[model samples]
Target: MVAITDKEFKQLTEYIKVNYGIHLKEEKLMLLTGRLQKVLQQEGFNNFTDYYHHILNDQTGQAVVTLVDKITTNHTFFMREADHFYFFRDRVLPFLANTVQDKDLRIWCAASSTGEEPYTLAMVIDEFFGKDKVFWDTKLLATDISSQVLDIAKKGIYSNEKIAPLPKHWKTNYFKKHDNENSVLIDKIRNEVIYRKFNLMDTTLPFKKKFYTIFCRNVMIYFDYKTKIELVNRLYHHMEYGGYLFIGHSESLTKEFTKFKYIMPAIYRKE
Candidate 1:
């Protein structure tokens, strides 16, 4: 096993945070080592330092993307936070319907890895307004830094085993069979969603229109204090005046001076 020396660990994590705004902790050493060994061998680097130096200059972003994919935790599920969805349906959606006169609604599934979270959001929206109402104007913009995952998300395919837990009617409503095997979202729903590659660390949000609600859940736990505050503030700036932010159940905004205030547990609305 190729172990990361303490110095190598420091250098690599520093590079990641500076370039990508990700903070690796002491406990991630084992995980990093496990993920990087294959990468190091592929790069023909004998030790950690050589791999670090080589990748630091890898501006094409391929190497860095792989590094990010390995280190970041992307564990999530459809309707994982059941309460948030119910709350949105009962509270936020009506408020949105009343206030936002425009039929066009923009939703950013900011950390939309492997497609589950954004697809789940699309399902909820489709359920509420039906396909005829939401099929055109309300776009679900799903983004992540990993091109690998974006491809999967864009394809909109999932194993039968993976999507098994979804309600049977929902599975029938949103998805179609793939090669008589796995499940994939129908073209109507799939087309409504736009999947793109985005690096959250970037200071500028690329979209021309501000988002109405941003689900950046579970992505920020990797960030240290400095990066977390900076990213949160930037997200706040990109949101609409009354926009809502949903972080992980484990994430908090009380530590920051952001104008966002708590709405329900783990849900915050912009002031």
Candidate 2:
């Protein structure tokens, strides 16, 4: 097993925190060592310092991609937070559908790990609009820093167990059997979500137009107070006025940290 020294650990953690906003504390040394053991062995690096050097030196940018994928957790499932979806369908959608004069219902799933959240949003939109869906544009932008999860999201395939939490009607209408053990999301729902690799730490958000709703859920829990506030401020800048932001129920943005008005336990609105 490759061991990570104190200096090496601090260096690596700081780099990730600064570049990606993923905060790793000193106690996570063992966790980091364990996660990167296979990568270190495969790449012939005997120590964390050497591995860190390789990551910094690699120009193709794939080294950082692999590092982020291995270190970050992407544990999400269908209907992970059911209340947010219900509120989205019941309140947010109706408001957007009626108010947006351009008929462009722009929604962004900023931390779209493996695609479940954005896909759920798309399904809800499809159900809400029903026959008139063709007249409005509801394409969603789903992004994450991990290219690996983004690839899985783009495929839109999941094990039966992974998708078991969805509604029966949703299972019936939006997915087709891929095999005995897995199912694939129908293209109608799949194509509605466009997947991209994005780092939330980027200084400028790369969107030409702002979004009506943004789901930047559970991922913020990994960042520290300062990092979290900076990210929230950035997200606030890119949202349309009166747009809603849905975060994980476990996460909250205190008034000092954000300008978004708290609407519920986990929902906020840019006003």
Model 2 regions lying over 4 Å from their true place: none
Which residue pairs overlap in candidate 1's backbone?
none
lDDT of 1 at 61: 67
Which portions of model 1 miss their true places by more than 4 Å?
131-136, 179-181
Residue pairs in clash, model 2: none
Q: Residues 23-73, candidate 1, lDDT per residue (tens digit)?
A: 888898898899888888888888999887777788886877888777766
Q: Which candidate leads the pack in TM-score?
A: 2
Q: What value does the lDDT take at residue 13 in candidate 2?
A: 97
Per-candidate clashes come to: 0, 0
lDDT of 2: 0.94
